[model samples]
Target: MIEIENLRKEYARGGERVVACSVRELRIGRGEQVALRGRSGCGKTTLLNMIAGIVRPSSGRLAVAGTDLTPLGEAARDRFRGRHIGMVFQTFNLLQPFDALENVLLGAVFGGRDGRAAKSRAVELLEKVGLGDRLHHRPNELSVGQMQRVALCRALINGPELILADEPLGNQDPETGAEVLRMLLEIAREEDRTVVMVTHDPESARFMQREIDLTTLRDGEVAA
Candidate 1:
């Protein structure tokens, strides 16, 4: 589902070059779940953002679902991401003014889908995530866990083929984090979508089928 070759990101800091991340080659197959594990400043989130097309690589190629992201313009990348990728961020990034269901519908709406059918899909996703009774609640009315669940629903409402989660469980307690991870994996498997998650917790990483330790990769190398 994802392929990267000679991926590298660098920055100019204090008149010196800083390598944020570099991956010589990497491939994540369809319907697979892979966890990217590394310490701070190891480029875990940098790589995730690159895959999401939110950040451009300084060099090399990144392809998702057969489309090379490197050459795509900003607008094209935005459309590509909205169409094929679902991202779950650590912040939950919900809309405060909108209710839970409305928030979920935003996912489909931004993906160029709207109307009754989109609403139905949003409702189904929210209910599936155990938010049926809380559908009318706004972001402020929900707990942290509830808010994250809503975020998950929002990410899946568009039926994306790839899911990118950046520190999905970093805010929750151990039990809640574990539960969320389980729900995420279960839903991804049921939908037959691939997942690439960035996580610090090894226990959480274990839930994925494969693990990529960024520290082990050379400055310009990525493990397959």
Candidate 2:
């Protein structure tokens, strides 16, 4: 679940404060799958980052899963995010040096799980994503789609209650992207996880239970 009120994020650029995202009020229920839509530079990704606690807000309030992130320090936010949120970044964000299995295991470790006990789950996720034969491959050794699947596995290895995905299907071909999104939603439905995804594609938006146009919540100010 997510709740926001008068939330705004601004960045100092060219000696002036530029608003990145502003939402007067928004609420997403538990187990909901929502798609966030907006034009380029409209702050869709910024909103997702704020909800994940990776970016701090300049003003207003944000609460995810009953915890208010506005007052939490970076360290505390990191701990809370690790425990409650899973993120699928547009860039994949996989460490180049770590193999696929190691990359997924790192996610579990970051979430405070024991690496030894997490290995089986990591392998299972990789296998589920059709990466069983590439478990020992590094990022450079895999294709773009493969790397994306690995990132998905890492996000799910922690069994997070909320998943925040920014352009999750941005890099893959149509078939691969559809497959990836299908797996994500199927797993979320089975586990009862809340999902908020930013997407530009209309077909992708159709998969969500609800669609939100970020521009509609901007309150007359343009996002940078």
The candidate that wins on lDDT is: 2
Clashes of each: 3, 0
lDDT of each: 0.86, 0.91
> Can you write out model 1's per-residue Cα lDDT over 46-153, one digit (the tens) per residue?
888899998888999899999999998899999999999999887889999999999988888888888999998888877766778999999999988788888888
Score candidate 2 by TM-score against the native. Answer: 0.95
Cα lDDT, model 2, residue 160: 97
Q: TM-score of every model?
A: 0.89, 0.95
Task: Please report the candidate that would top TM-score against the real structure.
Answer: 2
Off by over 4 Å in 2: none
Cα deviation at 27, candidate 1, in Å, is 0.7
For model 1, the run of ten residues with the poorest summed lDDT: 215-224
Clash pairs (backbone) in predicted model 1? 24-220, 24-221, 24-222
For candidate 2, write residues 1-224 as lDDT tens digits: 99999999999888788899999999999999999998788788889899999999999999999999999999999999999999988788999999999999989989989666699999988887778999999999999889988988999988999998888788778887887888899999999999998888889889899999998889788744
